[model samples]
Target chain A: MLNKIKRILIELGGIHRFVMRFFRELVRPPYEFKEIIKQCYEVGWKSLPLISLTGFITGIVFTNQSRPSLAEFGATSWLPALISIAIIRALAPLVTALIASGKVGSQIGAELGSMKVTEQIDAMEVSGTNPFKFLVVSRVLATTITIPILSLYTACVGLLGAYLSVNQHESTSFVVYFSQVFEAVSYLDIFSLVLKAVVFGYTIGIVGCYQGYNSSKGTEGVGKAANWAVVMSMFLIFVEEILIVQIIQGMRT
Target chain B: MVNEREHIDQHTKVITVKGVSKSFGDLDVLRGVDLHLFKGENLVVLGRSGTGKSVLIKLISGLLKPDTGTIEVLGEPVDELDEKALQLLRLKIGFSFQSSALYDSMTVRENLEFPLVRNKRHLSRNEINSEVEDVLDAVGLLHTIGQMPSELSGGQRKRIGIARTLILRPEIMLYDEPTAGLDPITCIEINGLINEVQEKYKTSSIIITHDLACAKSVGDRIVMLLDGSFERGGSFDEIFDTNDERVKPFYDYNFII
Candidate 1:
């Protein structure tokens, strides 16, 4: 048990240094804009279809689930505001992050793990290119920039789903439904959403890169790297979600 | 038993590793190993698997650090240089890995163009293409330039790997198992390529291999690495014409002597 704790602490220390090195390398000259653009396309554009479907489903389900609860209280009119607050402030970012943690995290982990085991990373280093800057920074920046946008898109799609659900019950107009939605969502909720998106995205990128870059030898190590990347990213995102909510609470107070 | 050539000129030495020792955990891979490479010669480090032949080259190329002692390459101490300085030094040294280490995602053309595009931004697209084609032609693999590395055979991949390194025209080439897992015909072809690169590019090289045939074909000087340190150093025949227990097994396995 003591040895297990020691290993965990050592791993955490390594991750801390790896993340610090990422920032140090990030600020250095000769940034890789082309690779960053390529990763943005990969992280954002490629993920759009799945994210859209998820957002729409979450919106419809949340609205349906809450309608009966509000009806019991004779407060069905409050459905849009409630759904909007919940989706934008919490569900949209969380759901989108979870999806990205599975998709993008696994891809980075597996790709880099293969590269590491094959000696391609060493080859890149010897060839006069900083593989960390070329691989890690570009990927992390892509996730950081793209995940917020993806989250915002998910929120908008989710609201549309909610609107559709409300119209099914009472012929509520789209503009009215949206107005009610926006009225309940404050600057703090949106701020919180964006903060969560950035943090979640950065966590996913760093965890995946760290796992892959330092991946052990052989195919088994690559498989473990990809698997752990998803698991760890999701865990960190949930933990960050709770903390960010507390931060928003402090802001409200 | 060591029967090295009597004529040693210190001025021609391109790489000098003195008292270098490296270890991982409790496993000591190289212990107080002293070696050197002269300009414009292929020095083969022959060893069985896990004898740290690849580790020695990696240390020379600045990919790995040693626990103790110094490594000097092209008149600069490898361990002392910072990142930028190390990168600058790396441009002068080309390391061809055992697995070929080709970027599988990239086409042969892009793979060839990669080192150039990164280091020589001043070159035009046409100039880069010309350089890539020229090196590919030299390696006799210009036909495979449009394909990805995965599409190529093991031998083709190895040639492309060498061509990729040769594109930089590095002064010192470190080849790690250049013919480890290939047919005899392809091994002979790779051997010819190594000698061709040595002649055409005028590059000093340290070819690390367990294959005695590869050592005999391209090696101007041969050193056998056993239990982490060099146990023999001389001509291929001189090193192997021995009854020493550590050296005879390699000779017995390869030749009919």
Candidate 2:
């Protein structure tokens, strides 16, 4: 047991060193600015349709389900505040992260995994290119920058969808609904969701790249890398969420 | 420093690999392989399957590090340089992959322009334009310059690969199975282009191939690799005419009449 733990610790230490070196190589000269922009579009902007669809429907479903319970309390007017808190502080970032873990994580993992097997990465190395910095760094940077934007966009659209759903039954104005939402949401709520999204982004990027960069064997390895990327990233996000919620509650107290 | 090392000088040998060996776990690929490349010489390494010819070119290009020994490119110790320094060195060496390895997402122009853009300061836009155009023309793919790799034929893609490598105007050119899978006509076309490019640019070249026709056509000196080492090497005539027991079978396999 002790030996197993020792091996795990050593592996973790090696990965930590590699990540630091990745960051260092990432920022130095011979920037792949074009590649970065291209990846940002490929990984980030392209997925807006799916992200928007999920966000809107989720908010609509949540509000519709909660309406009957609130109606019993004669507090149907509390719908906007209730839905906004649920969507922004809890559902939006977490669900967006889950979706992205499947989408971007698998994409990155498979792409790098294939490159590794085909010796394309080796080609870059021989050509005197920093494969880690040029390939991994650009990807990590793109995901880190874009995921938060996705979370914010999803949260806003989700609230709009909920407001519209609520309007299908209640006769409230858009102004009244938004004011209640703003009033109910505190700075802490905003901070927590944004914080979760950032962590989710980092988790997805790191785990995906790790799987792809270190993959072995052959064609089957690419699929394995993609599969592991999603599985590991989703698991990490949930684990992170648990710790973050506890830390946030402790800070509030 | 850049201009002086742009091409080979008769006085200065370009690439020197001394006692290089590499292995994957228990499988030792290259063992004690040493070779010298002069300025403006075409050196072809020929061998049967699993002979480590490709491994030799890769090590010289700093793609793979040797388990032991030294590789000096343009007098710089390649084994000692960091990743950044290695990339700088790569900018001076151009490689053509057998599979073409063109960025699939990019058009042919973008694929060719990629190394040029990355190494931007070396040449101006007009210079890059003419260089790309000239390279495309030299490879006889001037018409497909706007198409993506996915759109091109197998032969056409390889030609684009040649164009991409030429954009860098490398001092040392490495070809990994440059004509491996093409049709016979395409194979001959690629071989002729390889020779023409070497002469036109005055670039020293190291070509790895199992194709005897390619080896004979492109090689100024032919070296045969076998049993984890070089078995025989000489000028084309010396390699073909010699009747040594080990060397005779190779020519016989090619059905040389």
Candidate achieving the largest DockQ? 1
* True-vs-predicted CA distance for residue A105, candidate 2, Å: 1.8
Q: What is the lDDT of residue B75 in candidate 2?
A: 91
Please state the CAPRI-style docking class of candidate 1.
high
Residue B6 displacement in candidate 1 (angstroms): 16
Q: Single out the weakest 10-residue window by summed lDDT for candidate 1 chain B.
A: B1-10
TM-score of model 2 vs. true structure? 0.91
Instruction: Report the lDDT tens digits of candidate 1 across residue range B1-257.
Output: 23233333336899999999999989999999999998877899999999999999999989999999999999999999999999999999998989999998899999999889999999999999999999999999999989998899999999999999988889999999999899999999999999899888888889999899999898889999988998789888889788989889878887765
Give the DockQ of candidate 1. Answer: 0.87
> What range of 10 consecutive residues in model 1 chain A has the weakest lDDT sum?
A170-179
TM-score of chain B of 2: 0.91
DockQ of each candidate relative to the true complex? 0.87, 0.44
Model 2: runs farther than 4 Å from truth? A1-14, A30-32, A71-75, A123-129, A216-218, B1-11, B240-250
> For residues A127-246, what per-residue lDDT tens digits would candidate 2 score against the true structure?
545678778888887887788889999999899889899888897889998999999998998998888888898888888998898887898999999999999999999999899889
lDDT of 2 at A205: 86
